[model samples]
Target chain A: MTLDISAIRKEFPILKTSIGKYPLIYFDNGATAQKPQAVIDCINQYYQAENANIHRGVHHLSQLATEKYEAARGVIKSYINAAHDYEVIFTKGTTDGINLVAQSFGKLLQPGDEILISQMEHHSNIVPWQMIAEERGLQLRYIPINERGELDLTTIDELINNNTKIVAITHISNALGTINPIEEIIEKSHKVGAKVLIDAAQSLQHTTVDVQKIDCDFLVFSGHKIFGPTGVGILYGKEDVLNQMPPYQGGGDMIKTVTLEKTTYNNLPHKFEAGTPNIVGGIGLGKAIEWLSQFDLEAIAQYEQELLDYATEKLLKIEGLKIFGTSAKKCATISFLIDNTHPYDVGTLLNQQGIAVRTGHHCTQPIMDFYKIPGTIRASFSFYNTKEEIDLFIGALNKAVMMLK
Target chain B: MTITEKEQGLIDSFSIYDDWMDKYEYIIELGKDLPLISEDQKTDENIIKGCQSTVWLAAEKREDKIIFTADADAIIAKGIIAILIEVMSNESPDTIINAKLDFLKEIGLQEHLSPTRSNGLVAMVKQMKMYALALKMK
Candidate 1:
C-alpha cells in the first residue's frame, strides 16, 4: 500500500506554476493545504449545477441540496469514525468551534474552577478559553511543555483536581510538530470528571481519528487544512454532552420555534449551526474526504515520516541553522531559525526563489515567550509534498543564509 | 514629466492583481516607480505603528480629495503602499469613504501579506477613510 506520489502530484494544478524561473515549492501545508482538482471541481460543480439553499423550500432544488448536505455530514461521520451523524456539527472553522464551546461550557464553570490547557495549544484554542475564564472568574491553568515541545504529563496529578472542569490540548502542534498523547490526557481528565477537547487541526490530515477509541468529550478540526474548502470546519461532541450543552446562538435554522417570548432549539447539529451553513463548502469537504480515503493512511504516514527524517538530516547539516522542537514523535513540520537573520528576511528571500513557508509566531505567542525568540520559520508538509520539494526548500534556505551572512 | 490621465488610469486599473504569484514581483516594480519623500516627512509623527517594516504615511487635502504620501524602509512594503495610494488617492472624499476595497481578497494579495502587514494596511486605509469622514463632518 505504498503511496503513488507522481499520481498525487498531478491532482494539484498549482504545483506547475513557476516563480522567478524556479518552480513553486510549497512547504506551508500546516497553514493550509493546496486543493486538488477533485475538491475544486466539486465546488465548481455545486455552483454550476446545484447552486441552491438547503433545508428551506419544498421544491426539487431544495430537496436535492438537502440530500447532498446531509450526505456530506454522513461522509464526515465516517471519516472520523463517529458513531452518529448527529454528533458532527459544522462550524465556520476550528476557531469558531472552540469559541462556541468556550462561551457555552465556560459559562457553566463556577468561580475557582480550573480550565487546563497545554502551552502548545494554538491561540485559537487558548484565547477562547482565557476569555471565558476571565468572564466567569474561573482559573486558567497551563500544562507545561518540555524543550522538545512534548507536554510533560508527569505533573498530571497536580494539574487535574475535582475543581478542574475541562482540559483542552492540540493533537499535533502547528509550530513544533509535536504529536501529543491525547488518549492519555483524555483518560486522566476523565478520571476526575473533567471534559476534554482535542484540537485536531494539524493531525486530521496526517492520521486517522477514531473518536470512540480516544473517548474525547469534544474534538475540533478545520476543513481547509485537510484539502477541503476554507470557512468550513467540524466540531464533534458526544451525544450526551452536546445534548446537555445550551445553544451557542439562536437563529433561523437552529431554532425549532421562535417567538418574542421564547424559542425552542433544534436537535444536536442544527442547534449549533445557527445561520445558513456553508452548503457548498460542506459538499466540497465531503468530496475531499472521499478523495483522501481512497489512499492508504498508513502509507501516507510512513512516507511523510521518511520525508521528515530526510528534511531533519539535511537541515541539521546546514551551518548555523537551529531547528526547534526535537521530539521523538512529530509530524512533518519543521520550525527553525538561521543564525543572525530575522525570520521575515529569511521568508522573503525564500519567496524570491518561489519557495513558500510561513514565518513568525504562528499565532502561538506564548510558545514564542517560552522559547524566548521572536519567531521561527515553519515549513509544514503534507502527503502530496515530495522529497524534491524539501531539497529545493533546503537549497533556497542555504542561499538565503549565505546572502544574509 | 507631469503625471498623465493615462498614467492615472493605469494606476487605477492596477488595483486588481491579474495573478497572485506575480504580485510580489509587481509590488517590487511598483516600489521602483514611487517618488521618494523629502527627509522632513520621515518624522516620528508620520510613522505607522504595528508594521514589521517601517512605513511612514502623511496626508493632505487638495480639491476635496485626500492626497496621501507614503514611504517604507522595506521595498515590498513601499510597493504595497504605492498600489494602495494609486487606488485611494485623488478620489472625492465621499467616493473614498464609500469605496469597498475588496482588491486585496480579489487579487489574493491578502494571502501573501502577513497578518501584521495586513493589519498595517488596514490601519492605513482606515486612517485615509477617517480623513474623508472628518472632511464630510465639516
Candidate 2:
C-alpha cells in the first residue's frame, strides 16, 4: 500500500518543466495541489464531448449532462460519507461556501447570540463571520491557540455556553498545519445546541472526512486542494439544516417555479447553488476522488507522517532556521523563517533554483500578528511528494540563506 | 512620433527592478525627454490620488483617438507612466480595448509590485482605457 510516487509523478505533466536548469520541486500543496492527468482529461473530456447546460432540459445532451452532474454529487456524497447526496451543495469554492452559510444562517441569529471561531482560521473563514457579526448584533468570540498553534481546548467548556449559536473553525490550520480537534469541537458545540461549520479546505487533501461520523452540521472544502479544478467546492450540510436556511443567491437554476406573486425555491442543495454551476469542474472533482480512492488511506497517512518527520528533522539541522508550529498533531506543512533573511527574498532565491515554497502571511494575518513577524516560507507536502524533493528544497534553502548573508 | 529618440531609448531599457530607487535614475533621465503637462491641464480632475507617489494624468483627443500625457513625483512612477504611454498612446479606441497588456507579465513586473502599487498601476491603465471608451461613445 506504499504510494508509488514515481508513478504518481508521471501523472502530473507540469513537473517536467525546469527552473534555472533544475527540475521543479513543488512544496506549495497548502496553497493548491497540482492536478493529475485523469482530472485534467476529465475536464477536457467534458468540454470536448459533453458541453451542455444541466438540470433544466429533457433533451439527450442535457439529460446526459444532468446525469453526469448528479453522478458527481453522488461521488462527493461517498467521498465525505454524507448521509445522502442531498446534503452536498456545489459552490464556487470554500470561500463561497462559508459566505453562503454566514449569510443564510447568520440571518437567523439574534442580538444576544454568539458565534465562536478559532484564532487560526484563514481570512476566508474569519471575514465572512465578521461581516455577519457586524450586520446582526451578535458577538463574535475566538477560541485562542497556544504558542505551538494548538487550540487551548481546556477553555472550550466556558467558550461554548448557553448563548453560543454557531461555532465555525478550520479543520486544519493553513499557516501552522495544526489539525484542530474538530470532532471534539463539534461535540462541545452540539452540547450548547450550537451548529458547527468546519473549514475542511486544508484537511480534505491530507485526510479522510466523514461528515456523518464527525456529526458536524456543515463541512466545506475546495476541489483544487484535492487535485481537482479550481472554482468548484463542496458544502455538505445536514438536509434539515439546509432546508431551514434561505437561498444564498437568486439566479437561473435554484428555483422550482417563479412568479411575480411568490417564488418557490428548488430542493435542499439547489437552493444554495445559483447560476450555471461549474459542470466541467464537477466532473473533474469526481475523477480526482476516483484517483484518490485507488490508494489506501492508512498507507497514505503513514507515508506522509514519515515524510513530515524526516523533513522536520532535516530542516531543524540547518542553522538559523526557526520552524513555527511545533505541535505534535500537524499535517506535513513546515513554516519557518530564516534568521535575518526576509521571506520574500528567500522565496525569490528559492524560485531561481526551482524550489516553489509559499512565502507570505499565507492569508492568516492574525497568526503573523501573534508572532510579530511579517511572514514565513511554508513548504507543504502531499503523499506523492518524496524525500529526495525535500532534500533538494533544503539544499536550495541553505544556499539561499548563505547567498543572502 | 511625439517621443524623442532618448525617450524611446529609455522605454527600451525597461526592466523588472527598474522601479528600485537606484535603478530609477535612468527613468528620470528619460523624463527629461517628455513634454511637461501644461499648468492649465494640471487640475484636480486629472490627479490620481492614493498613490505613494503623486501622479497626474491628462488626456486630449487627436484624430478621433485619445492621447494620454502623464507625470509622477517619483522617477520609477514616471517610468511606469512612460511604459503605459508606450503601450497605449496613439492607439484607436477599439485597438486599445483589444490589447491584452500581457507585457506586464513578460517583464516580470506584476509580482514585484506591492498590492497597492499594483492597484495604482491598474488604475492608471483603467483610466487610459476609460478615455478610449469615452471617445468611442462620443
A289-358 per-residue lDDT for model 2 (tens digits)? 8888888887888888998999999999988889888899999999998787667657766776888888
Name the 10 consecutive residues with the lowest summed lDDT in model 2 chain B.
Answer: B16-25
Residues A1-405, model 1: lDDT tens digits: 988899999999988889858899999999999899999999998988887888898988888888998999999999898899999999989999999999988877899999999888899999999899989999999899888888988888989899999999999999999999899889989999999999999998999999999999999999999999999999999999988889998887998998899999999889999888999999999999999999999999999999999999999998888888889999999999877776765787788789989988899988889999878899999988888888888888887676555
Alpha carbon lDDT of residue A28, candidate 1?
96
**DockQ of predicted model 1:** 0.09
TM-scores of all predicted structures: 0.80, 0.79
Index of the highest-TM-score prediction = 1
Question: Which regions in candidate 1 have their CA more than 4 angstroms from the true location?
Answer: B1-48, B53-138
- Report the interface RMSD that candidate 2 achieves against the true structure, in angstroms: 9.7
TM-score, candidate number 1: 0.80
Interface RMSD of each: 5.2, 9.7
Give the local distance difference test score of model 1.
Answer: 0.85
Q: Chain A vs. true chain A, TM-score per candidate? A: 0.99, 0.99
DockQ of 2: 0.05
DockQ of each: 0.09, 0.05
